[model samples]
Target: MLWRRRAGMNGESDLAIHGATPGENIDESVRALACARHLPQPHLDRWLAMNERSRAAFLEIAQTLRLRTGQITAALELLEEISVRDATDCADILAAPEIARIRLHAGSAPARARELIETLRARRFPRLRETSTRLAGAIRELRLPRGISVVLPRELRSDVLTITVEVARVAELDGAIEALAARRAAIARIIEMLGGSE
Candidate 1:
């Protein structure tokens, strides 16, 4: 289970499983108990203090929502594309409602994972994503040079932009740069399309 920090009854901080319904299995409970046995004194104290129902729920939540290594890695990579603050906020939000919703859905895990990421990305960076989409549309209208690509910052902290120009030879480099520069006004129009810079 991926550990989440939660406030304890005494106002101290500790790691606990966040989402548990009554849908736990005996096997999972046994595994959880085994794991609990190896925990340090303070953590073990908290675990042992839980009532049977609470302990059972904890075990169930831990088993059911445990993120696999691949899922964790993918989520980290996805979050890396955004601001650190947004990443932290997304993680805090994902710990509960999103995890529960995704778990209850009927679909391929990968598909659901993609959906979760896209949804979170949109939520966390609505304006930036919208700006990027509109910028792509505007750039498409220009029929950009094959050797050039436009890249926007995930979070638009400023109006600064990057246009990548790829060329095989020195002769084509100037042409590629010029072609991209020719579309500057069109690219600039994206702020208007997005209803002003966000």
Candidate 2:
């Protein structure tokens, strides 16, 4: 009496309720939550497959943290990856000090939820955070004109850099261009980092 994901001909997942036995009450609650949140069956199955402590810990988090479906899915994925990498359980990962602080953070539920996912992401990919921080510091050191901005590639997945200038007058555009030219050498270093020369 649960939902499971079935890969279809197109290699996409199809959701349907299937039969499995576990802690009946927890399973039922998981099913109810899954249906209510429109959680995909694969995620639901993953949730149910957890040990009782882990399942209960996550369910508690889902309720008290007021997580939405997408957040839950993201949290589930991060938790699994962290668990595998650290050789720990989801319950332990969720209860880590950093996450515990976020859980008790006084911000709005949505803010805390977002921070939780980002914190998990930072923990899962520590080097990415460090690299992003370094890149940001490099940009700050340039101290270019106010309107000019260097856009980092999303998740550092691409080496492309986008520079934009906002100006209301020809004089302002001229100033921005001159400022960009002044910082050309430093900007090239940023490009080198983005190109994985770090």
Screening candidate 1 with a backbone cut-off below 3 angstroms (N, C-alpha, C), the clashing residue pairs are none
Candidate 2 has its poorest 10 consecutive residues by lDDT at 10-19
User: With candidate 1 superimposed using the best TM-score fit, by how many Å does residue 25's alpha carbon deviate from the native?
Assistant: 9.8
Across 1-198, the per-residue lDDT of candidate 1 in tens digits comes to: 433445556433334444664223433453455454443444434434444444443333333445344443344344444435554433344444555466456776666666665665675677678777777777678787687776655565556566677789987998887776787788777645544643
- Listed in order, each prediction's TM-score against the native is 0.45, 0.80
Query: Which 10-residue window in model 1 sums to the lowest lDDT?
Result: 21-30
**Candidate lDDT (C-alpha), each:** 0.53, 0.81
Q: Which predicted model would earn the best TM-score?
A: 2
Q: For residue 94, what is the lDDT in candidate 2?
A: 79
How many steric overlaps does candidate 2 have? 1
Structural RMSD, model 1: 10.6
Per lDDT, the best of the predicted structures is: 2
Off by over 4 Å in 2: 1-22
